[model samples]
Target chain A: MAVIQRSRADKTGIVIRYVVLAVGALLFLLPFYLLVRNGLATEQDITSPSWKLFPSSLQWSNIAELFNNPAVPMLRSLINSLVIAVVQTVGVLVISGLAGYGLARIPFRYANAVFYFIVATLLIPAAVTFVPSFVLVSSLGWVSTLRGLIIPGLFQAFATFLFRQYFLNFPRELEEAAALDGTAYWGTFWRIVVPNSKGFIAAIATITFIGSWNAFLWPLVIAPDQSAWTVQIALSTFLTAQTIDLPQLFIAATIAILPLVVMFVFLQRWIVAGVERSGISE
Target chain B: MSTVTTRLRGRHDRNLWFLIFVGPFVLGLVVFVYIPILWSIWLSFFDAHNTVTPANFVGLGNYVDMLADSAFRSSLITFVVFALFIVPTTFVASLGLALLVNRARFAKTFFRSVFFLPTACSYVVASLIWKLSIFSGVRFGLMNTVLGWFGIEPIAWLSVTQPPWYWLVIVTARMWLQAGFYMILFLAGLQRIAPSLYEAAAIDGATGWKVLRFLTLPQLRATSTAVLLLLLINAFQAFDEFYNLLSSSGQYPPYARPPLVYLYYAALGQGQDFGHGSAGAVILTLLIALVALGQGRFLGLGRRED
Candidate 1:
């Protein structure tokens, strides 16, 4: 009888857990559902007093309307954003990877000093240097240029720190075997370390790409011209316009988020692992 | 003699290789980060406006003016209130989500992914959605629509300050955007706790809240401290959402102005006072450093758990 009572209680507990989780899931997903629903709705459907979860008919043309809208320059902004994110990701990977490997493996006289200096840079908030960096970039005539967008952001101290921590645990035997085979340090790194570190590299690449793609403040300040605007900047333009077309704005937002959502769906494992590593690595 | 010389040459080569590997990154950091920081400090001492290069020297004038300015002072208070509310709120939410998701027996990954999906969305997109659709003042807005079912009148969410319903919009938007990321952090911390401790607790007749208080929360100290520090810093650095949500027609409302937004107006926006902005930036930087140091000491960060 006691065994049956315990089993019954366990069943109820499981049911309660499922019920709570279902409610939470719906709450989390509501905004995303609304995003798609409104994106395909007519302006009347959006602003109508009587709310409906779905529009009478889906307006797929809202996507075209957003793209063709002259003021937003959506196509140009999208292209710029793509170029910037790719370049910045590649740049951060190469620069931070080299520095991280050296700091981890090389027993040079000033290795600790160099590592500490780089780590100290992490504590200096970006806000302190925002104005001066802008001034410096503008003085170099880099305003509205891709170089302006990509070059200054290439050296990320946090990425370097993460890479160093990762490499410190890497098997020295692999590199030692390469050294014994007469591979130069550079060759050994490129040929052995880089190939073996693909997982970590992918993790960092996803993070850097997402960060650069979502970056708003620096791009907002650096690329003031409409021609040089990133997709984020382009999105902001809609809000500041004299009138906001609700459907078109929703369509644009949906477009802006689509790539990231796809990337998350595909690469979420690496993204989660990378974020976990960052939290606990210290 | 030849053997000794070869050994020395090898040592020299190793040093050279180190420099080669690390040189470009260190150089970039110096040029981009260090120089910019020093230049900002130097600029703070001068009356720089509309130009990067300034000749008019005013020692401590900008700093004094920034400290005295009502708007600048108020922005600091805004940061304090924001941090006070958001840090604890996000901490609890993230911890709660982590506990739930961790305890889930079925479709664990599904629930985790659903909660974390919003982290991939940009602050800009989230702000736009919050400002326009969810919190829109009209009766048709999602919040208002739900309220109508209960016979409550449609409230102008963002504009009104007396009740400060805008805080609801701002805080909820940020919570949705960020809570998931921190949940992942807490999940990691939870995973690191050894299962033996839980078994021991169960043997001791401890279950539910007792096990949580005695075994779980204490073990999560390091993660909790790190999360709090990160949340505080991020709160201090808030600009994108506030600027996007509150600002209309290139003008930001004075009520919700954080330091970064205020500085943007002073330097980059209409005011164009770079000196004052730099001074404010320096002050904010120092404040952050002080807080980080104090928090680290208080929490015994990086100390060995065992």
Candidate 2:
């Protein structure tokens, strides 16, 4: 009798767990559902007193309309964001990867000093640097240019720290073999180390790409011109406009989010693993 | 003699490779980060109004003005209130989610993805969705629509400051965006706890809440410390959502202004008071460093054993 009672309680607990998780999942996904529902709705549907979860008919033309909107510069901003994210990702990977590997593997006199310097910079919050960096960039005539957006962000201290931590655990045997075969450190890094570190590289790449893609403040400061505006900047402009076309704004937001969402879906494992590694590494 | 020469050559080559690899990064950091920081400090002592270049020598004047300004002080207070509310709220929400997701048996991956998908969305987009749709001040807005069903009048969520319903909008938006990422961290921490610990607890007749309280919570100390530190820093750096959610027609309302937004206006906006802004920036940085130090010491962070 006691065994049966325990089994019954266990069954009830499992049922309760599923019920709670399902409710939480619904709450989490509701905004995404609303985003799509409103994006495909007409302005009438959006602002109507009587709310409906779905529009009367799907307005697929919202995508085309967003792209063709002249004042918003959606296409240009999208291209700019793409270019910035891609270049920044590649640049960070190469520069931080090299620095990380060097700090980990090279038995140089100042390696510890260099590593500590980079780590110390990580503690200095970006809030302190914002105004001065902008002034410096403006002085260099980089304002409203890709150089302004891309160059300053390339030297990421956190990324370098992460890379160094990753490389510290990297097996020395592979590099030793390459060294024996007359491959210098640079050659060994490119030929042997990098090829084997694909998982780590992919993880960092996903993070850096998402970060660059979603970046708002620095881009907002540096790229005020319409031509240099990233997608995020373009999306924000809708909020401050004299009149907001709710559907167009939602559609533009959808477009801005679609790339990262797609990327996240594809690289979810690496991103999750990368985030886990970062948290534990600290 | 030949062997010694080869050893010397190897050392020389290794040093060269080290410089070759690390040189560009160091140069970039110095040019972009270090130099600008020193320049900011220098500018703080001068009257650098409407220009990046230094003007009259005003030793400590800018710092004094920033400290005396009520608006700047309120901004600091605003951050404290925000951190107090958000840090604990997110900590609980994320820990709750992590506990739930960790215990989930069926479709664990699906639940994890659903919770984490919002992290990929930008703050601007999330703020837009919050301000314009879910928390929109109209009867037809999502929250208002739900409220109508229960006979509550539609509230102008963002504009009104008396009840500060805008806090609900701002905090909820941020919570949705960030809670999942921290959940992932907590999940990792949970996974790292040895299974034998739980078995041992069970053998001691500790079940359910007791096990969680005694075993799980204590085990997650390091993760919790790291998460809180990160959340605190991120709170201090709050700009994108607050700026996007509150500002209208290129003007931010004075209420709900965090230090960064206030400094943005003071320096980069119409005022163009770089000296004052730099002084405020230095003060804020010091405050953050102090908080981090206090938190680290209190928590005994960086002690070797987990």
Candidate 3:
């Protein structure tokens, strides 16, 4: 905690810190730089014997071509993914937020029981249910539809657990104050409880949105048809082939992930703070 | 829930709310998860020919036969080997990266963000990067393109696993995707360590290795345990990349795909061999349970429920 240390100790620590950080940063940045560079470069650059991270001339057409590639509906897929991601995020936040409040604040009997049951479900892998989920979606005629995609993800026990953890640490007097003003449980939940949970809600929503956006297996299983596919499903179809163009897949891969990365930048600092704090005692 | 005053001796309709919050997931699980799982189990014991006709039960014969199959043994071994290499290496690399980022005085957010960029990428995107650039198995591939500097001929990276090069492909893809995620977890753990601990170490002349060894390592036991368990779980769930990358041609390296991919191929890729696929699924569930139990025992994960 001292601002000043022995000159020798200070010198050694600074060198050690910067050198390790530079190497670590490079390890993280290289792959991403390659992915983005590959997407922007021309076929000649990609196929060239000599590698260059910087390109001679920017080929800006890859983005246009990526969207226009009728083989994949890039714009529509984005719209589809956006609609699904937003709606699912909102729905899950409300449901899990309320559930989290009830579990953490209400202190009712079977609160722990309900919590344990939901948490147990977390350990069950989706692959085990692959067949039946497919059959159920198909049976309900919801397969290959956005409804099918959005509904299943709306319920997340981990999200509930997250909100509950934050709620437990919250000072209880806010709810008590609202109650003294004649606020009902539901009224207090919507007003005082939710507004106060802005940071936690944002963290939960970001996590849920990312999960929904990156989802592949369920989307692939339920909507294999190109017309109904999310961009993730569409990008994966490039793989079910004899020979794949590496650059094109790189372009598509970049396209599929760019939006989420943008969203992540806005929320990473807060989410990391929240998730780390949650893990402090867990 | 009713007011605590009247509700002190009474129960809120707790299951109703639990159902509202967890109902969707549970309903989805039962309709989607439980039924399929139980069906798979029941179907595994039957000669279910992907037909509408009734499946005739054949007792434990399917389990008996799968246990004797060499392909089953090899795929199981492949999963185990992949886990062994990927888990410890990824954990160490991620934790090391976390410490570096944590200690850096400048641009900590930028470094953390860059480190985590890959984790947000979809598996298909990541897999395609490996497939087209590095594992293209052609002269144009990146690895070969790079090796051209040394005057070595193009080597087919994906197919030529006389050295099990497919494992390399799998590991490379995994490291790129996972290292950032575990880095976040480690950074989180790093923040929780009290500054006093480090200061105490400093007073004892524990500035570098001595401080790290005495302070950081001992303080990180639980986090390390969680990391180990999570890494193992993630490794065990290796489907997205393997499924996407497994070469349709015979160019696939020997023992390239894991049990899940093989199960997918069996159930859907080939003619419906649900019985075999179901058996594989059963084996996977059991394997996951066993591993969880082992880790729980080793880490004492839930022992001190504060």
Query: Which predicted model would earn the best TM-score?
Result: 2
Which tens-of-lDDT digit does each residue in A67-153 have in candidate 1? Answer: 887877889988999999999999999999999898888779988888778877777777557888898898899989889999999
* Docking band of candidate 2: medium
Q: Give the runs in model 1 whose Cα sits over 4 Å from its true position.
A: A1-7, B1-9, B297-306
DockQ of 1: 0.55
10 residues in a row with least lDDT, candidate 1 chain B: B297-306
Question: Per-residue lDDT for B100-132 in model 2, tens only?
Answer: 889988899999999999999999999999998
**Residue A145: error of model 3 in Å?**
2.5
Better of 2 and 3 by lDDT: 2
In model 3, state the lDDT of residue B160.
Answer: 70
Model 1: lDDT of residue B7 = 56
- lDDT, residue B26, model 1: 97
lDDT of 1: 0.86
Which candidate, 1 or 3, has the higher DockQ?
1
